[model samples]
Target: MDTPLSGSGNLPPKPGNRPPLSLSGLDFKLLRVFKAVVEAGGFSAAQNELNVGLAAISKQISDLEIRLGMRLCTRGREGFCLTEEGKLVYQASIDLFASVDSFRDRLSSAQNELTGDLNIGVIDNTFQDPNSPLIAALRVLHDEAPKVRLRLHASPLDDIERGIVEGRLIVGVVPVYQRREEFDYFDLYQETSNAYCAMGHPLFDVDEHEIDVDVLRGCEVVNHRYALHGDKANFVTLDGQSATASQVEAVAMLVMTGRFIGFLPEHFAAHLVRDGVLRALRPDLINIRTNLNMILRHNAPRSPLVKAFATALGVDLKAL
Candidate 1:
């Protein structure tokens, strides 16, 4: 009855002629040089740091400019400066190199029995607190991972967040006045703010009743520019400027001049308070409470070192 049909009639032959995707050419050496130049602030400095000839550095940068079809730097007698494109490229290079460094660190950690690099960012005031959990955690990390290299960066909260976002810092500890949805913040500790001044300051002996907000209205106050607060209600605006000091130590030093009073975290000012170097003003007047948090990018892939550090820090990585 009908023609015999072979099983191959219904099946299509396998295709074997697909072409592979072509990848864009990238010169890692040029990228490295670009990053070095940006960091060193000029070609000569980068040449010195990289230990290369001036001509070689120049050629490499020129090649990079040609490859990207953009003028990266402006060369003149006033010294070298990055152009708009150069600025963007420099930022990109920073991120790229940071990722490469992290990758290398992870690989080295895996290969070596006990070694790795951990990049961490902390607010200046956090470390100054004698009872800070970070100090204890660092001690534990040192004991447990003795061979691991630790890199700590202390800066303002905004800079710390930028470092984390740019992949420069693996983790950050910052004061959380408001929650950010893009990052995961683990509550570490809670603290209260209080007015502080040097032992010799006039306000040091002021009575609680006289230490009201009105009294602070006319007094010179040194405010920490990076402190977490919404309203800044109790702050005494000196010269109509809100930011005078970026670090808590700077604020403390300013207060030591006996010319200004500052608001400081209870734990941060505890030692000075105990040693009679600084006194609190109307302890009841300062009622702002804030929580210190361990922040990390929500979608970042955690390496073994990061996981271990998080565990040591008493953070539940899985939950985060």
Candidate 2:
């Protein structure tokens, strides 16, 4: 007779029966407050964070529950706790704010005033190479997007490549040994390295004629961990490997100990050689030539900053 009053005793109508809520500015404000309250663990704890009084926050939460036609949280003696519906809403709020922030970043990028982060990963010792365009590209990025924050990480090639694939880095500069399908490689330049011995090593003062392949093969050497997989390993015999290093700097340290021989990029070794700190073992017989490349995920869309960097590096986008 009386339409059963919608749910038998004035309880809020079932979720399916209620009309959907159309979000307004006020709704956003209320949700923001609700988010702060939940994050702070209770209304009283959120006062300093929200900069509002307890009564005002309580009123806002009550208003939000009324507008949604659902109980969002429980408070008082039992302590603040979210209802099942409240938990779902809180999770959705997180995703919603992220999308909003992304939209803002997109708008800023479109206006040519990029103000988000640009993460770049590179293999160590690249800055010392006069041929690398990385320094010039960084200068260009700084001049153009002065507001953008540039984050640079120097690590091993394998770590750099992994960072690019996992979206932790926008771009990576590394030596290409074997190309992976996951990356779009843009050629940067080549580097040359030769085996060397430090000042205190036995061969540092040995005559060239006395250092034959057999003599070198019998000496202790340091092997690059990453180069063990391909032809790169074949450049120098690994039979004498008594130590392993992941970085060129580490290799230098080992070589300097006068107990191991290791390969180093010519440019990186030049100053050390000039200072009489190291001497090349046999450049003519033991050397490796590697092409360095800039890599990005083949499937991911390039960010504006990445595009700018590629342009600065003179990479032919059409080829990629």
Candidate 1 lDDT, 94-175, residue by residue in tens: 6776676668767766776446568799887666665458888888888987877898988888888887886667899888
Regions more than 4 Å wrong, model 2: 1-105, 229-235
Q: lDDT of each structure?
A: 0.75, 0.80
Best by lDDT: 2
Error of 2 at 193 (Å): 0.7
In candidate 2, what are the lDDT values of residues 31-67, reduced to their tens digit?
8889889867899999997998998888788777766
Candidate 1: segments with Cα more than 4 A from true spot: 1-30, 36-71, 75-80, 98-116, 142-147, 199-202, 208-214, 217-220, 231-243, 267-277, 284-287
